[model samples]
Target chain A: MTTTDPSSTTPPPDRRPGGRTARTRAKVLDAVIAQLGEHGFDGLTTDTVAARAGVHRTTVYRRWGDVGGLLADVLDAAGDDDWIPPDTGSLEGDLCGLNEEIQTALTAQPPVMMALIASSFRSEPAADAQQRLWEDRYTRCGIIIDRAVKRGELPPGTNARQLLVTATAPVYHQLVLLRTPVDPELPSRAARTAALAASAGAFTEG
Target chain B: MTTTDPSSTTPPPDRRPGGRTARTRAKVLDAVIAQLGEHGFDGLTTDTVAARAGVHRTTVYRRWGDVGGLLADVLDAAGDDDWIPPDTGSLEGDLCGLNEEIQTALTAQPPVMMALIASSFRSEPAADAQQRLWEDRYTRCGIIIDRAVKRGELPPGTNARQLLVTATAPVYHQLVLLRTPVDPELPSRAARTAALAASAGAFTEG
Candidate 1:
């Protein structure tokens, strides 16, 4: 599988997976998300992560510099930009494409996602990165809507920006904010809902 | 001033607010929200909150039983059940009404709101309570859209639940997930947009 390129230009810990540094980073990052899911922003600490990961305290501190850096790395790793925009010649078909992407993501691992959200309040870098992630996601989203706007399937002056956001925001609330998992069917439903919403006049063009 | 009525057979702690016990409870609750805003779930501690609030650490431990319990109390304290149904006599009024309520609550204390979001991931009681909070908000939302469904402004077989959620999900995303604050006017604009979307046919009853 092709791996997501880390947005952080930080050199990979000069070691292969299963090697000492790789194993250590993996252990610590995993532990951080786990502890964050269990604890919260104010509850997370390097000590707890190290203990959970079974790594030496020095090793944890040395690699990431501090908890903030560690969290930044975790969020970076978590933001898998593997989504492929759907081109189904219709808004409904395109949304199904996007939902499938999110479903794949939610199924793979929620640890980093849980941590990024948990710590977003306290960490400025995390906040910035988190916003950037959305900007990227929405930028991708507009591509699908742009087609409808072009085809006159949607209103002439539809606010593609709001349409893009309105389309994806539900899956987010459903998966991360709400406790219940999004139904396997929810993605397709969401896509159609978004497409229909867009067609119904969800935006205002400048 | 007239106090909120407690005659509804609910627990005592919720009904009243004032003595040293009330003050202590409020401070501890405030501290947890503030600390969580500054800290994340895994970083929280009873010690820190007690120190921050100038209450005895033992008092905090005694009242809440633990950090989890403290989070519950904090969540409870944040609630205001003055749910007002929108009555502009149109679907547009209802949508704007729902949007305005959420914007007010979120901007009331941004840090606290962020802290609550982060904390819910770690604490089950916090998450459940938060879910109820969303339900409270959603229920009010449903009231608005149901009016529209009755008015025939929407298509027959409209799913008010899905429609209402799709309407405001972007507002939440703008503030919470995207970290971009919504403009004050955007709420009203969004409401209109959503109302139109509903009219033009965005959702179907499941």
Candidate 2:
């Protein structure tokens, strides 16, 4: 019997149709998310993650190095998911959609979000990753404000990031900081409040 | 040499005038705050705290039992501090004052605040303490909104909690979530936005 070479078992990075390298990355990342959801940041360990992913500990060590590296990959993969901000014509509708997205994330996977936020406070690498995550989210969500401005729903020069942050902050405060249940009406209320503020030009930077 | 009883060396709990009990408690609490500020929640431990406080390990063990109990006391003491919310005549002034207070806390002791927030996620007792802290802050801050309504600055029946949460969420998002440098203008801007929303009746529960 001819022995198969280990090198032949792995595909090049560009290979598209379910290559071994791609499969390994996917499995590792999926395990990261699952671990974050189940145990939070403090409970995450490379060995545990490797065991969960059914990968060798040395592979995890060589690939991710540590928890920070693993966390960055997890956040990067999450950021790469296909998500388009809503274009509902009206500023209120756009903001409501945005709020709904935040609410859904916080409600459905609180542990993962909490772990990410907590990581921002603990390590430099995690902070960099979290900052990048927020920057990416802000850039994507800014489209709502841009569309609203083009539609004459908001005045020109409105700070899109500020508006979105204002609209979303209370939802996070309720769910994370206050540890309170986010009522169904809270997101709509936040969106309406933000819309009112935006129309009044409260977000305009001088 | 006359022998003294070890039990008699300790003063009763209620005895004041800088008694040993009070001094020990003060040192322990101060050490807790210092540990939280320096090492964050993850690095804190009873043995370390007791050593830092120069108190007996048994004393810490018997008194606090765990980190959660120590955290509860720390929060309780912080809440008990003499701080009256600003009652500026207008909603803008009151909110601005409120914002400044939060900004000061976040800026002056970011690690302490971060540790407290992180602790809330890790333990049920800490979560309870955090919830109570927010509730107390909200009630105290509500007086500002109440006065605003009395002065006809906002619509009657406006949700005080909603307005305060809206006004402060951005500050927290800046300092904690986004990890952005909180510009001096951010708090006032947030106040204006919340004020605009309150005037538009966005905070009214319908």
Candidate 3:
């Protein structure tokens, strides 16, 4: 319907009610990821995504608005997944598990994760969406530190966000920033380092 | 001269042996940084850079080839600076100094450093040059760890690259990747965490 015009719509129904609308959104977003993975942000366009999603170009335009909107929605959809933090009994183990997942996502074939990160630099909408996703992830991972404090593996008053950032920053630095060859030991080593620092109350809040 | 044609030249003389050549290189590269800071990668162009540097378009095209080559040269020039790591007596202090420098570069008014990082994602040549620049900085900063070992602040055999990465990644991770607001304490806190972790032999090589 012409009522679906994004200019007139207040919220711009990305999650429109009804099975058909839901399916269209899912298909469009899925296509966005696939296109980003395969062609990168430079090659992505509403026309390409619409063709790949088997949807009308006008529909794609009305819904997503632009490439930035498409990229933002893809990241927003990612945060909707039920991604619970690992519970490996110890903080070190939990961090190691988390690091492994990060490593895998970063090194995935077609480099979708890295593409999204790169896209965020070019798109304001994607950057904002990514910030939300990161905040959501940080909040979710706070439980890892909570569990560790309960297990007496870490001291009370440890700042979970600080410790988590310390533990995970190395992977992103090494793999993404430096573009270094992957070191299999990096994940566990970084986790151990952060875990040790946390035990010493280095991340404890005032 | 026709001899300066990039196709005929095997080495592509970015640093030709003459005061004029040096001056031109300096002017152009400086212009590249200024343009990148002012307009970002999206707005950067060979024509705009040439105009900014007061150089002819033909000369800019002959030397730089394209935006990618221009970006690569800008990064390469950064590695030529005589940047010695801070010798702040203690490892934590040295790391704090290093982190503070990183924070400033990342949060500069025009955000030139961050723009270079964002450009690397879109340009293959820029990415390669950035990798080399990172390697050079890491190697140069190794002296900080060596002095720490000698001063008994950290254990012998502590991995300098690993320790430096641990100390510095948080700043980049927070400022660049997550786009978090600058926390003035982050530099020292991260440095202290990394120094403590190194004292515990977490980064010691096998």
Candidate 4:
């Protein structure tokens, strides 16, 4: 994470991906995600994470500070992955594809995504990182709306973020909030609903 | 708060609303909600709740047992309220009204609902209690779809739960998950989108 303090005279040196420091960081962050998946936020401890990553406990404390720091770094690492929204010719197809990806992640054994979401509420740093990650995702998915508009499937002024939120909210609500049993048809059905609403200008910016 | 142990032959007496036991239960539960809104789950303790309720700490521990137990009872208490869905003549109006109610609750000072939601992730008892509360609310809200169907606004065999989830998910997603600045227009817009989709048969039973 970049230091936010403007008073710092000397900048921290950048560690290349192959460097020992970078490798250690990766190991620790990977362990954090795995640990969070296995044990929800309450069970996550720096000592356990350090043990899992084969790092010294003192080093873990000196580096990450606490569980919140570990969680924030894990989320920041996730944002580093080069992920782009799907392009399936039609907006509904793309949305369905995106929802399927979310479903898979949220419904994974010992679901890491759901665990992280739950942890964010307890950790301000993690919550901030997640917000940034969500914004990045929203921006990337804006292309779906742009393409739909060009294809004459949606209004030119349709709010991309709103439409995308409408399209995807049902999946998150079902899996994370309600903890309901998975419905095989929800992904396509929700996608179709959003697409229909968008085509009817329900998501058009006022 | 009903005991699940079948081995216990003695049945607990039902305490009337005006009874001392009932009053103490109400006070303690109210304190839990207040403390949650003020200090969040991490700040909540049996001592603090007991002090706030003017009840003894030992009594609280003996009755509610723990934080999870207190949270569970609070949710169970909320379910006792007689809340019915809006009876607006138009489906859009009713949905919009319901959305407004959700928006108000989610956006309240200190945001008790958001605190409870976050706390549930950390407590199994609270999660189970919340599930029951959600199911009850969903069942009660089913009347919205029935009224809409009878009014010819929505098609027959429309899945009430699916439609309601689609309509309300965006508000929770934006407010709780993203923690975004309030968009005053979102509640009505989301309701409008869902209403349009339902009218188009996007939420029809498969």
Candidate 5:
């Protein structure tokens, strides 16, 4: 019998980079986020990233191995202060608050965040990084819906992750893909839709 | 004091050295789209695009002008198929059909398409091209929705453009930014949502 598996890993390409100074690495990581915001993934390059971070060229290569690795690390670091969905004990209030929080954050350099999400298509490191990035946000969202489910505010079989992704994804596309300015009122409306979707069993596993 | 527009024409960055060659342009465009599908926009280059197209290094630049221009042309040509929503006389059926058509066209090469969209941020030409690409699709969509409005299938106040964009944008993101696999069924769900949203006066103008 022939074995069939499309899943395969490719070896990482070595950049032969001289390696960055420790201080430069930290700065570069921050700069990666900012650059992602500024230039977007397509526009970002090692030269630009290095310049922005004030790091030596080789250091970015030796440390990150490539652009994908660098972005993955940045995503890992961006993990902070992004999660933490509120729980007002009511699913509606919790989601509304979370959407508001996201909307405010989106207002600042939205292109960068969008680019990061968009960048996940490149390969190994990017795919892994995006997965990690979404995992954190999804987990936080899951907790809120789980609470709702437990309290019977939502259906007993709600798939919180689906509800969360479906709800927020529209907001992301409206701003990022379409390049349309977000309506100020839409975030709360999204949350309301999310809450209703939850109550209406749109997320119910059954 | 001085009254003037920014410029009669945008920069000619899209122009390459020498002059444009139709054959070279078409080949280079193919290469760009092919590479974009495989390697994504973040890390690809004119050299690679040239190599893939079997053109001289100078030809890539001389013909397409630059990577951005190459990408813009490729995307424009891809969407030149001129898809229009069928006049099935039912808004729900029309949207669902269009949704499925887009899903079929997109999910197979979603990564490459997304990479192009993300890269558009860095190049004004690419951005302009993207807008043009969407306009064609949207125009056809408008025709369908507008007909529905005339038939009373949709509310008179419907924001057809927003309704159309919302219905379609998520499908793009599912395969691109969210990295979710797009199932054939999913498109119909999205279309149904849009149809229902429209019927509920979600598209109505205030």
Candidate 6:
């Protein structure tokens, strides 16, 4: 028996069948992403989303309650379907992989990201969703730092959240604030700089 | 002759006496800020701003042209009125001062900052203002890093923009993205971390 590569063998999460309920969820969420990209948070309405999704308006209202609920579900679905943290035997490798994943996501769907960011600032539900997403990502990325610490690659008591945030903040700043191009070298540079800082205990709480 | 402290002697920019033209400009800009804070960019309209400012609608239309123009003026006024980068004799002190200034501005008027950020994403004029604002700050803070290099404190050719961005990005991430409380110690920690990274050539372009 031979082990198969998960990437090669596994069906895309949305493509895998779970019957009618899953199909409806996939359709609704896809419509939500499309609408968000087209109209941003301000212009998005449940009626529009329901119409676009070809689902009943009452079903959208009853299920999601409001724009915020719908947004939260969209965010949850966005995070749920992809990109588990990789364990690549070294902190640098893991962090680089994580940064690459981020770069890919941001590049692949910039408009959706822009909408999500705008929503986070203006809408309470969206803000909550954004917070939960960051917190969840931070918790998952903690394993990379923990592995590094165990291998004596980083100092003990390293602040994983700080490290991960520091590594990724520049990328977000570039994408969202500065509107600068995120060059190919950026992810590795960010990861390397963060790894260096962590090794020197810059992220350790005093 | 004894020298008086500049801060004590200098009238605040907004309070300084000027003619009717200056006063009118100030009034309009103040209204822009208020409208931005209250309504954000999407909701802000030049007519509403003119109404709020108690100026003639035609005057606003002639002066600012549109909502984006008003927002650009607001951002310019916001950046122009306050927070000159400090020359605190050392890189760490200067960086800390810079971060504290940012924290102060963000805390002092969160709604205005949020409005500016939102506008930057949606409007071209606002995005230009945002870009100019960051470029100006980065250039001003470059003096800090240059001084450090001259004093043999940091390595030569260190990228000032990178250092300042890295030091500040986490704070912005907390405020804008994470919606987390920026603790009192965060400024100093960010400064220290950037300083450490700068020393290690993390910010030096290859």
Give lDDT tens digits, candidate 1, residues B8-127. Answer: 564444325574577787788888877876765656799999999999999988778777888877766655647566788988877777788777766664466766776776678888
> Which lDDT tens digits does candidate 2 get at residues B60-122?
999889999888888877787677888878899889889888888888754687778767767
Q: Measured with DockQ on alpha carbons, how good is candidate 6?
A: 0.56
Tell me the tens digit of each residue's lDDT in model 4 across A135-168: 9998999999999999999889999999999999
lDDT of 6 by residue, A29-109 (tens): 888889988777767889998899999989889888888888989988777756579899999899888988877777665
TM-score of chain B of each: 0.71, 0.87, 0.91, 0.91, 0.77, 0.84
lDDT of 5 by residue, B1-206 (tens): 22334574643333343234555677777778778778776546889988998989887777577778787788788677756576777887887788777677665654565567767756677877887777777876788877888998887767767677656755765765666665666676666656666676655655
TM match of model 1 to true structure: 0.73
In the range A1-206, model 1's lDDT, one tens digit per residue, is 12335786655545645556767778898898887766656667888888999989888888877778778777776555486578889887887778777666654454445556656656777777667666777777777777887888888777767776666777777777765555787777667666666676656554
Task: List the TM-score for candidate 2's chain B.
Answer: 0.87
User: Residue A21: error of model 1 in Å?
Assistant: 11
Over the stretch B1-206, how does candidate 4's per-residue lDDT look in tens digits?
34345576554444644556898998999899899999999889999999999999999999999999999999998999989999989889988899899889999998799899988898999999988998898889999999999999999999999999999999989998988999899889999999999999988866
Which 10-residue window of candidate 6 chain A scores lowest in summed lDDT?
A11-20
lDDT of 4 at B106: 92
**Model 5, stretches more than 4 Å misplaced?**
A1-28, A34-67, A80-82, A88-93, A110-112, A118-123, A147-154, A193-201, B1-28, B38-63, B79-81, B87-89, B109-112, B150-153
RMSD of each: 7.3, 5.3, 6.0, 5.8, 11.0, 8.1
Model 6 per-residue lDDT at A96 = 86
Model 6 bad stretches (over 4 Å): A1-19, B1-19, B79-83
Best by lDDT: 3
Would candidate 4 be rated incorrect, acceptable, medium or high by CAPRI criteria? Answer: medium
Best by TM-score: 3
Interface RMSD of 6: 1.2
What is candidate 3's lDDT per residue for B18-136, written digit by digit as tens?
54778898899999999999999988999999999999999999989999999999999999899998988889999999999999999998999999999989899999999999899
The candidate with the higher DockQ, 2 or 6, is 2
Give TM per candidate. 0.73, 0.90, 0.92, 0.91, 0.72, 0.87
Per-residue lDDT tens digits of candidate 6, residues B8-96? 95644543457455687889988888877877776688888889989998989988899889878777766686556888888888888
The local lDDT score (0 to 100) that residue B164 gets in candidate 4 is 96
